[model samples]
Target: MIGVIGIIISLFLLMYLAYRGWSVILIAPVLACLAASFAIFDGGSFHMLATYTEKFMPALAGYIKAYFPMFLLGAVFGKVMDVSGSANAIAEFITTKIGKGKEIWAVVLSCAVITYGGVSLFVAAFAIYPIGAALFREADIPKRILPPAIALGAFTFTMTAIPGTPQIQNAIPMTFFGTDAFAAPILGIVAALIMLFGGMFWLTHVEKKAKAAGEGYGDHKNENLQIMDPQYLPSFVTSITPIIVVIVANFAFSKWILPSFDSSYLETDYDTSFKAVSGTWSLILALILGVALVILFNYKRFDKGVVECLKDGVQGSFLAVMNTASEVGYGNVIKTLAGFSLVAAGMLSISDNPLIGEAISSSVLAGITGSASGGLSIALATFSEQFIARASELGISPEVLHRVASVACGGLDTLPHNGAVITLLNVTGMTHKECYGNIGMCTVVIPAISCVAIIILGSMGIV
Candidate 1:
């Protein structure tokens, strides 16, 4: 009971600090240390610390190994795309295709393509902002529309809407359900369609209404808004090479490399095999591909630009990557205290209702972590096994619960301090007042619709 209290208190404190504008990476470890100290002083021991270190260190290391390379590779690719002018080339192509009168639709489609193509959310914001802003200026659309439209178009759907996306949020539940990406394709597709249509309709309505009221993101006229030159264009194929490499590598590793490695001498289960292949090797290959593209595409004219770009990319990525790493480390600390697990057990013990159980778990963790991915990770880590057991007992397909958890992961997860959201805000030079409506639309509205769809589908055994 005391342990559960410690967990709740720690979670609430973390959330408060996050709401107060502390980064999750900083807040998590500090809170974890505080939780550990409280547990220790309350009769836990140094042995408890040691146990936590043993368990969490490996998980943290694994997470770093798995994700860091992707970040580096992505950063390098984005930098290359920026310098080589592929982004502009693609933006131009999109603009030409959409023609002059439909700038809003062009912005939406551009964001969707870049996001679904696996660009980092921050990079997507920065890359698309100038284009969207320029487009809005030319089309007489309000500047206020650009931020939310870009955000919704880039983040809401494709993060989980497309099956086989390799999104961490989607992948986390697979750790427990033992299901593949295809397991809930129908659900993902349905959710994606709903988000896509809803986002487009809302943005269009807001634009027209704002225009009618003569109130739009405070008029700022600039002469360069309509220019769409391709003098600096780089090859489109070269620009997208890294995304292709990562996706293909992920698929190949899942299908062949890991299976062969496991079958030969290891004989591990699917999950273990997945972890092995999806971690260090996959990322290393991705980094190599990114580097190769930099060399092949720009080495002659740019000379040392590739090396400089690599350094800058890695350096720029550190804060965000470390933030995620620290969150993982904190989660490790919580696991060490067994505080989160105790809360889960207690919730189950008190209420046999799965809906109530899910609500209790998601609300606490989501509220605390201020990250959909982080909060859902905590919930899934704590309740996955129990959820499976309950599903099995009730003759429900465990896949349904797994899908429910996956869809639920997106709800209200973005903390004011979330690195991605903060990065987006910083890049766009927009405040919460200017942008929170859109974030709320994606993080709250879309997820609510998704949850309803999940419940309906899950209950019918269709997920």
Candidate 2:
């Protein structure tokens, strides 16, 4: 009981301190030890230093070992896209076609198109914001609506529910489930359509109410807006080709290319099998191809030069991976406690359906951690075996489990403390009071609905 209290207290503090802007990399280890202190008092055998060194460090290092390439390549890919003006070019192409009067749709679709193409939501938000701001300003739409519009596209479907998205949220389940990015394709598409249309409907409704209320783009200074000159931007075709390369190359590698290779040497040489690592290998190769293609297509357009862009990307990946790795380490420490058995049992009892249990655990942890990937990683690392076993017992596919967990993490992860939500609001120069409710409507409420829909579909044997 005392140990359980410690786990609860550590989680609350983790959420609160993170919300207060403490770095997880700092807070996680401290909190893991805090929880361990309670475990020690509760008569559990855990040494704080040993736990940190033996348990936490191993978990953190293992995650980095497995995933650092994807993070590094993904960051570099996003940086190249941003610096080369491909992201802006794509956004401009979309918004220009949609035109000004349809500001909400234009903004959402612009963010969505680029995000679905494998750009980071942060990159998508930054690249699209200037154009989206200009559009909202011209259309007399409330500036506050812009963040949710961007969130609906970048943070929800494309981030999670969509098939073949290279977002780490979708990719995280692969190692655990032995699934690829396109897991449970039918259910993925179904949930994606729901998130797309449902979020669009809600944002459009918000636009209507704002129009009726006569609230124009609120008075605010849009400083450093930096809308790229259209002629300076790459052509739409050149801009979109790398994105297509990522998608097509990822599919090819995961489906046909990697499987054809005789990875028999993997078990002999590395003491692991090809099946265990192929999904990650596919993503790494695909992102490399994507990054190489981006440079090839826009080599001359790199204003800061290719090396600088690559350097920035490599630097950027370190923090992103370390933050999630810390959370993973924190979770690994928590699982070693005597209290965790009760917690595990309680999580499992959330529903008779293993899918529901998986979804709830993923969603709750993500909300607590304020990170979709962090939450998903912790939930899966700790509970995936049990989820797999229960799912198998019920004749469920790990593919459906993969898809459900991926989609569910995206649902609650947009809580007000989320970094992406905070950054989106900051970049758009909007207050949380002004924008977060609508952002919630799109990223939180709508995605939750889609999650429920997919879980139901999966339970109905639609997978």
Candidate 3:
């Protein structure tokens, strides 16, 4: 009972600290240490803190080793794409091919492709902004529309609504649940469609309201719609090669190659097999492809100048990556202190129904973490033993429970203060008020609806 109360209080205080702008990395661990101290002191100085620190320090190091390489690879990929001009070239090509009249659609479509191709939100934003701005200027669209539209395109659909996207929001679940990208493909597809249509509907409605009041909402027009000189361009094929390489590698490895390799050569466990494919190997492949693409595409332009651009791009992403990586330490603290485990255990204690237990646990953790990936990791790590036990006890399939958890991950997990959301708002120079409507739509409304739908579908054995 004391353990449970301590867990609850610690989680609440962590959320408060997060809300107050304290780094989760700092707050979560500090709270965990305090909770552990109380737990140990009450038990009469068992040296639990020293034991925990010794074990946790190594575990934390392992997590950093496992996680940061992937981030560094992703960062390098983004940098290469940015420096090689592939990102901009793709954006420009889409706008030109789609024509100027459908500028909004063009921007949205470009953003979707980039995001779906596994570009990070930050990369997607920086890559698409200039193009979106230029398109809006050319099509007489308002500046205000560009930011929201770009954000909507990048975040709402591909980030969560698409399966196998490698967006941390989606891919992180795979890390925790041992579920494949295709586990809830249909759910993701349906959710994405709803969000896409819903966003477009709101965008059009806003445009109409603004125009009706004669405010000239889209009144600004720039006459510069022409494509720039060919010297600044890379071929369309060159620009899309990295995306193709990553997707094909992921698919082949997951579907045919890894499975075959595993069946004959390696372990039968899904988690172990997936780690081989999605972990260091995938990152290495991505980095090689990105480097190769940059060299191949810019062979003529390769000089000291190219090196400088690469350096600048890498330097720019370093701080952001480090900040995000540091937050992982907070997540580690929560996991180490058994805070998440206590919460999961508490939820499971109240319910015999596995689905209900999962939903409740997901909601609580998601609410606390304010990050889908973070919450999913917590649930996965903390609840694995319980999940296996419950599945056997309830005659439920572990796979089904895992899938349900993954699906719930998409909807209930991303709260208002998600790093991605904050970063998007910061980059666009839009306040939460200007974009929270859309944010709420994606993070709250759609997730709520989708969670219920997934739960029902799973309950019915339809999924």
Candidate 4:
């Protein structure tokens, strides 16, 4: 009972502190240890220091070791895309084609494309936020809604619903379920469409209402978008080719190349197996190819040289990966407590259908953690074995489970404490009080509703 109370307290505490802008790296271990003390020692000495060092640190280190390569490559790829002006070029191309009256469509599609191609959410928002602002301004749309417009593309669908999206949220489930980024292709597509079209409808309605109320793009000074010089940008083909390279190469590697190689050497004394993680392996290759292409295609255009881009990317990956890794660590500690079994059992009892249980469990954790990948990683890492076994027992496909888990993780993760939401709001110079409502409608409400739809369709054996 005390242990269960600890888990409950820890989750809300973490959520509140994180929303207050505390670092998860610091908050996680402290709270994790506090939970451990209540569960592990009962009325005895809490041994807070020992629990922190023994349980929390190892989980953090282990996650870093397992996932560092993916993070590093992904960051560099996004950096190269941004630095080469490919991101901006592609964004402008989409909006230009869509034209001024359709600011929402242009920004949403542009952000979605870059994000689905594996760009960081921050980079996705940062890369095209100015364009979003300008388009909103030109179209006489409200500036306050820009974050959600940007989110509809980057946050809502591409992050989770799209099949083979190299987003970490998509990849995290693969290692656990022996699935891939393209898991449950039909289900993924359906969910993606629902999230995409459904979010579009809501935003379009909001834009119309705001427009009817006579709200124009407010007086926000957007230096990032304003300072971008058009002449130095890459052409459309050059801008999007790397994105294509990533997807094509990822498919080839995941479906053919990596599986052909023998990795029997990686299975001793570890719960992890390279055979199970081929999805991440493929994404690494995909990101690398994308990065190389960006550098190659834009060689002459690099203002600060490609080396600086590499450094920036490498530097950027550290905090992003560490933040998730620390959350994983905290979750790992939570599992060792007696309370977690009760928590897991309760969550698992949500439904006899494995997909329902998986989706609900993943979404709740993600909402609590305020991170998609972090929440997915923690849930899958801790309970994947159970999920897998149950799936097999119920004759449910792991691919379906994978798709459901990935999509569910994306839902509640956009809560105010979410890193991506916070960053997007800051980058666009809007407060949560101002724009978060729209952002939540697009990312949280719409995605959650989409996940439910997918689960229903999946339960009906719709592939």
> Which has the greatest TM-score?
2
Please state the error at residue 366 of candidate 3 in Å: 3.7
Q: Candidate 4, overall lDDT?
A: 0.86
lDDT of 1: 0.63
lDDT of 4 by residue, 1-463 (tens): 8888888889889989988889998999999987887854455446787788888888889889868888888899899888889999999889889876788899899999998888888999988888887777777788888899898899878889888898888887887888878889899998889888988898889888977888877786644556367777899899999999898888888889998998776687555677587888898888988998899889987889888889999999999999999998898888888878888889989788888888888998899888888888888877777888887887778889899999999999999989888888888888999988888988999889889998998777776
Put down candidate 1 lDDT per residue, 336-370, tens digits, no spaces.
Answer: 67566665577677666453465456544654566
Q: Rank the candidate models, highest lDDT first.
A: 2, 4, 1, 3
* Model 1 stretches astray by more than 4 angstroms: 1-9, 19-23, 36-59, 179-183, 220-229, 237-262, 268-271, 274-304, 335-367, 392-403
How would you encode candidate 2's per-residue C-alpha lDDT over 181-244 as one tens digit per residue?
9889999999999988998888888888988988888788545788889999999999999999
lDDT by residue (1-463, candidate 3, tens digit) is 4655665676678766765677765565566655565555345332446634654354445455655555555666677776666777888888889995777788888888777766666788877776776776656665566656776677666766566565555554455445545446666676677767776776667656765776442433442333345468788788888777776666565556655543433355443554434433543564556556666776665345766766765675555444443444445555555445655456888867676677666656666666665565556556766766766676665445655565566555446666666666666555676666656664556656655665666555554
TM-score: the better of candidates 1 and 4 = 4
What lDDT is obtained when candidate 2 is compared to the true structure?
0.89
For each of the candidates, the C-alpha root-mean-square deviation to the true structure, in angstroms, is 4.3, 1.4, 4.8, 2.0
TM-score of 2: 0.97
Q: What is the lDDT of residue 56 in candidate 1?
A: 50
lDDT of model 3, residue 165: 62
TM per candidate comes to 0.80, 0.97, 0.78, 0.95
Candidate 3, which ten residues in sequence have the lowest lDDT sum?
217-226
